[model samples]
Target: MHRGRLFRPTVFIIISCILFLQGLSAAPPLQTGSFIRDAEIEATLHEYITPLFRVAKLDPKSLNLYVIVNPEINASASIRYSIFINTGLLLESKTPEQVIGVLAHETGHIAGGHISRTEGAMGKATLAAMAAMALGTAAAIASNSSDAAMASILGGMSMAQGIVFHYSRGQEGTADSSGVHYLDDLKWSSRGLLEFMQMLEKQEYLSPDQQDVYMRTHPFSRDRVDFLKQHLKNSPYANNRLPQDFYEKYDRMIAKLSAYLEPPGKTLLTYRATDQSVKARYARAIAFYRENNFPEASKQLDGLIHEFPRDPYFHEIKGQFMFEQGRLDDALTSYKQAIEIKPDAPLIHLAYAQTLIEKNQPKMDKEAIHELRNVLKDEEENSFAWRLLAIAYGRGGNLGMSSLALAEEALANDKPKIALTQSKRSQYHLKSGPDKLRAADIQSLAERLVKEKE
Candidate 1:
């Protein structure tokens, strides 16, 4: 319930957002939608769901959570222990409890083995690819809500791919029942799920074309409502409310997303000038930045930083703003401050490393390489980090290490042939050492993968 952590921008990975996409063995790369990574949002979600996963006897570590940058009110669980949630659902939720409720339902799907029962028209690899395609790269840019919804939800594996990420009424009912039990066990209210269901009930009357993606996929029923209503009536924890502090955190999360993902004008309108709340000001600051009103944006951010100097996210965003504006020195200072506050955040380190690499100063290359290596420790398959590491190594005049990094990057990005070539180049340049051994290993793996393609 601690609301100390906050979101920072600039950790978007075309690959990391789809956590499983990088490890695909023989499958072709699928076009991915925009997925984002925010340390605070992901951490908050992890906090909310850890209990549910525990209650369900699911390994929290094995389960991956992804936030797709789409404005569709949908969430889905993959057969491979991954959960995908859209930004629209996060923004649409009235409270963190509502989000938790939905997540519990998804957890139910994972716990109940419903995902495996669903037809695998797409093989496990394809299914993983599809689930991953749901979120990746940047915010989804599809202009048409319907198309975007289907693409984001199904990862473009809709009817065209002969795949429907739907569940039967019975499965949904089981998930609802399981979700209710999980919440009840934790002494939390079931009202969040009930209210979310009731909210979707209205969409049932609409045509399939007009209905929200959740309705089309989840198959809502009055029986679901009646069952939840009955459970709430009898459960002792039925009236439980989330901590008041959580609501503020939830609002800040939503505000950050809206400021970054929504139209600048729309975000500004929603978080009006008169509303002096932290969340409101945060939204306005990002909106002003998006509008290119740097002065006003800096004013808002500076005020927030003055008030909350220790907040790493404030510094993180200030760094992002500065980096994007080509103010490398100012950006470096802010990013360094953010890292000083939250040293363990890999994404922030990744951003800082990227800025260091971009500054193009040889003296900083060593720092950039070190930071990139730290990022890879946490995110080994992060192709972006590998790519940045390659740049850092190249800048430091370590061609052998640079080639090895590029090979790693290529492997992560599913370009095994390129990996093979780069690994060979790396071996040619390096003497016998752990780095050379790594290059040899990459060569063998890449060669095998390339052969698998043939």
Candidate 2:
């Protein structure tokens, strides 16, 4: 989705709205933090959890999933109906079922209402603390590159570590049971969950610092392992096999992550040229690109495109490689191909819009603006898209709309002062209209938020 390697983490924060609107229909304050945003990976996650959510009688749309950029093997559910899964957990998982097991467990917590009961007493304090940290994270994101923002963002994560949803031992046991039950109801094996717990059991004797973040937060026990063991023995679906397509997708996901997250040299070594499997070729292509061996990367990617023309990800990654190398025309062609295959992916749309904007053709600015608006319709809080939209409007010679777009960008990035200034500027430059009226609303909201923070 970004200009970075495919499946790699891009640092960005979604900060809280400081004040909740007063009304019966007032929505809960959105949580704040840094995380990866990849359309392909997110779609895969949603696919894995859909049935789990359905079996648990929870609405999939009501729950949000975030892939935290941390390397700790952890997944946590917040009382606000969000699940945060660390990148380490995704990469470390050997099978889709293992990851599904974890999601099922988290869904158990959500369905059992464990999060609120455990976190209710500390809700206000946790919310206030995370909101305070949001300003620093947002500032770091605004001022730094992805790599530079890692430390500050992780520091922000550490500030709220182990406090958000520290479930009790009893709750953990209940979640285990519920998780396996959901898997069983779907006729999927819970063996993965049992295997995962057994792996955690070995860490029980390790010192606190030596244990994984999940162990520290989830409070693993031998009893939990035993519960899973006994359940597997009794459950009829314990040995059920997942679809072949699941493994294929899971393997590709892992290969893509390794190629992006691991060192280029390491990925090349792991997936050598002698290996011609789809996963190997995918990894090697990314590794070659990362190593700046464009010829080899091109060969691999071109082969992939020929072999699997319908696979949008291959085209998407090829587009990213071209986009990074400043081949706007080539990138645009690849991105358009990807979009044709997968029309609803917002990240791909964001990249396509970015490519159009970078072309700097006056005629193309309108097309860029159209793509950006569609992206915003899907992801209204995407500050990066808003920033691009501002640039597109500026290039189109629309100063008032450009200023209004900057106001929206600043608002999404939690820069109240900038939003206040830009909104006022937009109001002055534009004639009375819906957009000008929207600027007035932003100015009012920004004014209130600024005053409250002070």
Off by over 4 Å in 1: 1-14, 17-32, 117-164
**Full-model lDDT, candidate 2:** 0.74
Model 2 misses residue 43 by how many Å?
A: 1.4
Pull out the clashing pairs in model 1. 35-136
Tens digit per residue, CA lDDT, model 1, 64-183: 787865566888887557788878899898878889999999999999988743234444334343324332211121232333433443454332223246788999999999999999
Model 2 agreement with the true structure over 234-351: per-residue lDDT tens digits: 9899889887788888888788767776777899899988999999999898888777788998999999999999999889988878876778799999999999999998888877
Q: What TM-scores do the predictions have?
A: 0.84, 0.84
- TM-score, model 1 to reference: 0.84
* Backbone clashes counted, model 2: 0
Model 2 spans > 4 angstroms off: 1-34, 116-164
For model 2, give the 10-residue run with minimal summed lDDT: 18-27
